[model samples]
Target chain A: MAGKRGGNLNWFYLLLTVVVLTGVGLMVYGQVGRGKTRAGKASMAPVNLAAMAEPDLIKAARGVNRGAESARVEVMVFSDYQCPACAYFATNIEPQIVKEFVETGKIRLIAQDFPLGGSHIYGFLAARAARCAEDQGKFWEYHHQLLALQNAWAYSRVPPVETFQSYAVDLGLDAAKFNGCLNSDAHADLVTANYQLGQQAGVTGTPTVFIDGRQSLGPNDWDVLKAEIERALGL
Target chain B: MTAAPADHAPGPPANRMGIALLALIGLMIAGYMAAYMLGLLGAIICGTGGCETVQQSPWAVFLGIPVPFLGVVGYGVMLGTALLGLQPRFLADRRIAAVLLAGAVAGFGFSAYLTWLEAAVIHAWCRWCLASAGIATLLLGCAIPEVKKLRRS
Candidate 1:
């Protein structure tokens, strides 16, 4: 009886082992072959830049807040939309600074593009998209939309030209004009100019803010920023 | 008259093989955990926040679960199975050893896929991830011979 049981047990183990090994082989093959499908799907999306406009920021960009200016210090922020830390700073820190400084006319915020090439594939496109929105007087609105969708861009294998357009559409932008602005090489030059300027200013990474030409090394909270602004202005 | 057969009969060679496999797995788990922790610390010190970038990437979450957390659970399960095999009271059936070997093979295959993604897609290598892959490969390689032995018996 014991001899019979041992023989049966051996057969069972051999069969199970084969099955497991086969399953693993199939999984590895599938992963390598099918992983590129996601990238293909992303590439097929339409590239419409007009879909990214925001009404509130568009109006402000067109000089509606021109009369509300406060301080004389110009704050130039060199940023990449696909950068997560930049997104965090834009959401958590930029708002307060804008409300207290930019909105109050104490500072004029100038956004400069500085896309990192290695990690963020669509970073340059997003920067160009923001500039395209600028032509329609919706620069700030488009900026916020790009930063808010940073994660979407970072993980996307294909460039997110279409995604940027969707943001313009949500903001009620003119589709034809937005598309024209996006496709034109005009904005590309502007993005390149910003990149050159950023490099010349010794900016090495995204979210490198220059308050009157002095670099803010990292994402500084509101208090440190406020102090910097005051000191820069000799107030 | 011949000496009586030794009382212990040196338990089956299969049991000894199982213990060795388990010890190898434990070593792998420890090596990988240490590498991951060190990589994270380096990223933090550099101020580039590369660690967050690597961690938040879609590859970091396989099937919506954190990979590191999954690794921890997998190692624990493997350790338990090894301990069960080591106990002398329970018969060290070849079938049980085969099943465990199969699991190790599956884990090795998955680790290979992850390593490919790290190189081709993510373009950033996490030293710890590489260490895990290496360990999984070694464990599977050693288990294959044991599996063959179980089959012949």
Candidate 2:
């Protein structure tokens, strides 16, 4: 009887300790990590241009392009439309580049599609939709729409192609033409080519940018990107 | 608080195997979620980048909260049931065994589904998630015979 009592007492202490430790640990860690995550500030990999010698500007890829064909500086971005990091770059950083460099004719900005496989359900579809929208001379508008309305349809269990069409309609694109292009998979080859180009450039992550031929070390901040552009342009 | 008197026979050896298995599963999932929720980027088990990708994916969340946190809650309840039944008088309770069995089945089913998604949809395997799946499966194995033993008693 004494032995049994001892065993029961041991079990009680062990369980008590485990429960208390779990509760306290959760509180501490939860408090620490919550703020950073909520701020939508996950760490971005720094752009690394140290490996290769820079190259002179090449003509932009065959997809949606902005700026002049003969621009001296080319900034090509490899991106997954469904990736949050890519969205962050598009919303916060790309605008600055466009305003300061792309629109001013100092640089030609090109977007290459590299929709991440698997978990990103609508990546390919969204890229395809943007290609279709591009067919009507509204490529940049459609690209912005996808990144802008990402929260609406990016996570849907089913493809959000209809939402893409609605965005096209909002842009005053020819709705019938857009639908035909989408249905026919008119730009399947284009999307595939973009992805293949990205892979060839050793892009393993989204929002990987190349200025001339040098890859971006980290393009999340505006000043860093500006400096990179200046260095590439020898300005 | 309800410690039995020294004269008790300790209630049929206390179903130690079943109790320990539940406790193990509960602790592992709790630790994994707590670490992740605390902002640890890499999975508690293993990750070459796959873990972070899986965690950041839409499937990782349910509604607005992370899904592993829900697994913690489920495991907590299962652990509570096992801890309560450790009392000498309740050690052989058929009701407790039945609840444990049900919890095991449910846990296993959910774990199985998530594992499948990781392979087919997510295209990345989080080792921690795989660990949870394994623990849930082992707990189910422990639970079936436990239910039988308590019922026979």
Candidate whose lDDT is highest: 2
Estimate the lDDT of model 1: 0.61
Clashing pairs in 2: A46-A217, A46-A218, A47-A216, A47-A217, A47-A218, A48-A216, A48-A217
Q: Model 1, range B1-153, lDDT digits (tens) per residue?
A: 353355524333343344344434444444344344434212111113344456546677778667776676665556556545544433356765775687678778888998887767765566656677776776676566556547656
Error of 2 at A85 (Å): 4.9
- Please write out the lDDT profile of model 2 over residues A1-235, one tens digit for every residue: 1145325456555665676677668657865685554233322433333332123211223546799888899898877788766776788888899998888888999888887776666788888888888878898888988986677886666777788889999999999999998888687777876776666566667777788867765566567678988888899
Chain A TM-score values, per prediction: 0.68, 0.74
Model 2, range B1-153, lDDT digits (tens) per residue? 475666765443344445555555566665666576555632121113566556656678877867777777777777777766565566667887788888888989988988887887666787778888887887787677666656677
- Show where candidate 2 strays beyond 4 Å: A1-75, A84-109, A118-122, A148-161, A184-186, A210-235, B1-39, B42-54, B57-59, B76-106, B112-130, B145-153
Each model's lDDT comes to: 0.61, 0.71
lDDT of 2: 0.71
Candidate 1 lDDT over A190-209, as tens digits, reads: 57666665555555666666
Find the 10 residues in a row with the least total lDDT in model 1 chain A.
A58-67
Candidates' interface RMSDs, in order?
A: 11.7, 7.8
